[model samples]
Target chain A: MTATAFQFDDVTFAYRTQRALEGVSLTIRSGERVALLGANGSGKSTLLRMMDALCFPASGTATAFAAPLTEAAFQDDATNYAFRRRVGLVFQNPDVQLFNPTVSDELAFGPLQLGWEKPKVRDAVDTVSARFGIAHLKDRPPHRLSGGEKKRVALASVLITEPDVLLLDEPTAALDPASRANLVGFLAREPGAGRTVVTATHDLDIVEDIADRAIVLAEGRVVADGPVLAVLHDVDLLRRTHLVFEHRHSHGGPPAGSHGHMHSSRQEG
Target chain B: MADQRYGICGCGRGRRGALDSLVLGLVNAEAYALDAEATATRPGFLQSVDPRIKVLALVALIVATTATRSLVVLAALFVAAVALALISRIGPGRLARQVWVGVLIFSGIIVLPAIFLVPGTPIVHLPVVGWAITLQGLRSAAFVVGRAETAATLALLIVLTTPWPHVLKALASLGVPAAAVAVLGMTYRYVFVLIEAARHMMEARRSRIVAPLDGRERRRMLMTAIGMLLAKTFALGSDVHAAMIARGYRGEVRLLHDFHTRPPDWVFLAIALAVPALILGLQP
Candidate 1:
């Protein structure tokens, strides 16, 4: 069996006064491209953060690469650095990640932090800048980029680190239609061999194209774990989990892909 | 690399001014990052020069110009400054528009009692206040104004030429402590993101303004807006942090080198430094 990439055995968490996660037992294997499907406040993002070792679970076991998830796992700066490089996380909004004056610096930030030499850093910056089609944007201020461009820049920033696993939170939110299509196509086709990618998204259509499998979460526990075509459209289960949207008419068809977005039934269409 | 790339920068003063700004700011060794950029007239110039040299040069010039009370020397330094700015391709008008705060330094000492203090002959009487304008007073005022104008011009020229990165890069190259460069680099990257976030925060609040509030509620409304902005800023900070982590940053900074000093750079440096060094060396 593939070694566990990320696993939590009865993990639980609380945010100040509210309980966020409880008894969430799951094992995600290496190279598993799973889409994290959940309603708002279902502890999806918190779970992704735990995998990256950003926030610790209040109780129970969360492990990555067979190492028990603990403060000691990140006690050494090198360890924390390696952890960050190993599991990258992209936010929904580009405003959170891109803080540089130009595209090159923003892309280079990660590699230099990884302690690569100057020449290597520069090369990496250039490569990723081109990869995201921002090479011309090398000198442009990141904030001025269009919504799609900013998103691409943000992704390039993380990919420069060449992470082993990618955790994306709402990888597409607030993007225009063409850009969204571009992002979908890119994510679906990019290199992820031997690397795990778990994306938390509200747009079920993305889950159809990019992800091979799905993990459904609602109210902090996993409800369904199966292929993307099956779990996403399970309307009765989603409604039971409080995740069925007012727009979803039925499930069980060509998946909840973009074409079926507010229309409800994909079978009818 | 592209010649026409800077046209879209929107500084509106043509390319020469922009390039001068990119270069001079580096010479003056201005503090960098978005904060400096926000208050700064130009940052791209300073980004190319070695930070330590720029810092030292700025400090040295400021001292040489400000230490004395001689109109003739002050006038010479001011002329030299304008000449440098012109050579750098920064417009005189751009310099004028750039340094409003700098003029206040001369104004602060405008009413000084140099005439009363100096053991020299009085020159002319004032028309309005009937105050005696002594030779010493005129000399001192000229010195102060000239000194400030020269100093301001030099600094402003530096700012116009340098970008924030080059200043920091120069600092790091010049043996600024590692932690300092690391912090500065990180913050500079974040500032652009923060500004973008700020725009969103403001818009989010603005969207809720279906109807305008009365005069008395304006303060409270602004306070709420500020509070919301701060809260969103923090949230964005965390999200950005996560995004950076995803990008695979490990807290290292490596600045790209835009210049390897040509013989011309040395000649320029020699001329630039020689004038000030000679002034200080051959002081009366």
Candidate 2:
């Protein structure tokens, strides 16, 4: 078997008095595009953050790249830097991820933090920004860009770092249809080599294009883990996990073809 | 999407009543957007210079403009600032409008009362009881207004000519604490985000309004909107901090390029610094 990129050994975590994750154990192999499918507050985001070493497991062990992640590991400067450089986590809200004034600066932020020299940082930023189609927004401030543009910049900022693993939290939460399709197309493109992509989203429509594998979470527990098509096609399981609900599309048209299916529903805690 | 239950707008008659504030908000938004975009796009005199030099030189000029007590020097500095604005291709009209609205008129209003209050030879008698414009008071008021105009013009010139990121980078390189610069950068970035969020909240409220609100009712709703916006800002701030940390920000903010001073930068710096000194030295 391929080396595990991320291995969670029965991890459990909580915030204040509430439990966020409980006895969640899973293994992600290298180069695998895996989707953490779950409703809101289902611990998908917390799990992704743990893999990036942004948060440590409360009880069990979470390991990345063969090393067990720990509070002490992140306390060490070299280890913390290396861990952060290796794994990138994109926040759900573009406003939170994009804190730089201009798109160029936002894309340049991570590489510069990694202590890349001026020319290298600039080159990386240019390449990634161009790839993400944000070259026109180079000097534009993040706050001024439309929602789609900001999301593109946010993703570009993380991708510019050239991390080995990418952890995306609800990457398409607040996007319009055009932007959503654009992102799906970008994510579907194969990056030449070994790069693991783990997306924490319950967006079923994107699963087939973005990821081959699906790990479904419900109420802080893994209810299903299998191929994307098999898991998402299981309407009963999806309904039981509260990932989709029955909705009648009565306003748009007279019974349209294939429009009879239920739409995905995002649960709120 | 909320249904448009009214004609010509998402809100009915309520939209007309809110038109004044809406127009004001749009103007402020456009002003900020134009200020950020116009300077960065134009290839002009000040835009080419190093941001560090521009910031330092303009700041020095502001200080000198305020320090000199001579009305001639202040007027000379104001004239010089206008000349530079023309050369820099920053719309002279725009700069004048900003200074007139933000500084000149404000100073004019504040100094108006002083013109009648200070004791001196009465130049003109007003229709008001026991009030006359004094020559000394007028001269002193002119001094106050002139100083203010000069200082404000120079400050606005700097902001209007330089990109905000470059300006922040220059500040950071100039020994401003990294943490403070980071905070300033975040605040600058998110201020617009907060404004946009607040606007969305207001729009949502407007969509839900079934009837026109009286002034008191509108004020209460505005207070609630402000409270919610503050709460959202707090939560957003934490999330942004976490995202920063995840991306390897360890207190110190690192940028792609360091400030490099070219020969032109130095020459520009020299002229900028020398103008104020010459004005001060040549004072009669």
Best by DockQ: 2
Query: Residue by residue across B165-279, what tens digits does model 1's lDDT show?
Result: 5666667677777568757765766555545444454445445655545655656755665577578767766775656554444444455554465454455456556766777
* Quality of candidate 2 docking, DockQ: 0.74
What TM-score does chain A of model 2 get? 0.93
Instruction: Write candidate 2's Cα lDDT for B1-284 as tens digits.
Output: 12232222543544454533653465476567666567665888887889899998888788778778777777888888888788888667787676756787789989999999999999999885868999999998998998888888888777878877888888888888877888888887887777667656756775687766788887787677767877999999888888988899887888654567899888878877886687678766
**Model 1 clashes, total count:** 46
- Write one digit per residue (lDDT tens) for candidate 1, span A1-269: 78888888999988897887888988888898888888779888888878878678889888888877887767677777767768787776677677665677777777776777878888888788778888998876675589999989888888887888888888877888799889889888884688888898757767888799988887778878898888866877766766544554345556664242332221122
TM-scores, in order shown? 0.80, 0.87
TM-score of 2: 0.87
Whole-model lDDT per candidate: 0.68, 0.82
Candidate 1 CAPRI category? acceptable
Clashing pairs in 2: none
Error (Å) of candidate 1 at residue B198 is 5.2
What are the RMSDs of all candidates, in order? 8.4, 4.1
- What is the per-residue lDDT of model 2 for residues A1-269, given as tens digits with 9 covering 90 to 100? 78889998899989878898999999999999999999888999988888877778889988898888999887888888888888998898998999987888888888888788889888887798778888999988887788899888888899888888988999888888899889888888934368899999988888888899999998888989999999989999998988888765555556663354577863221
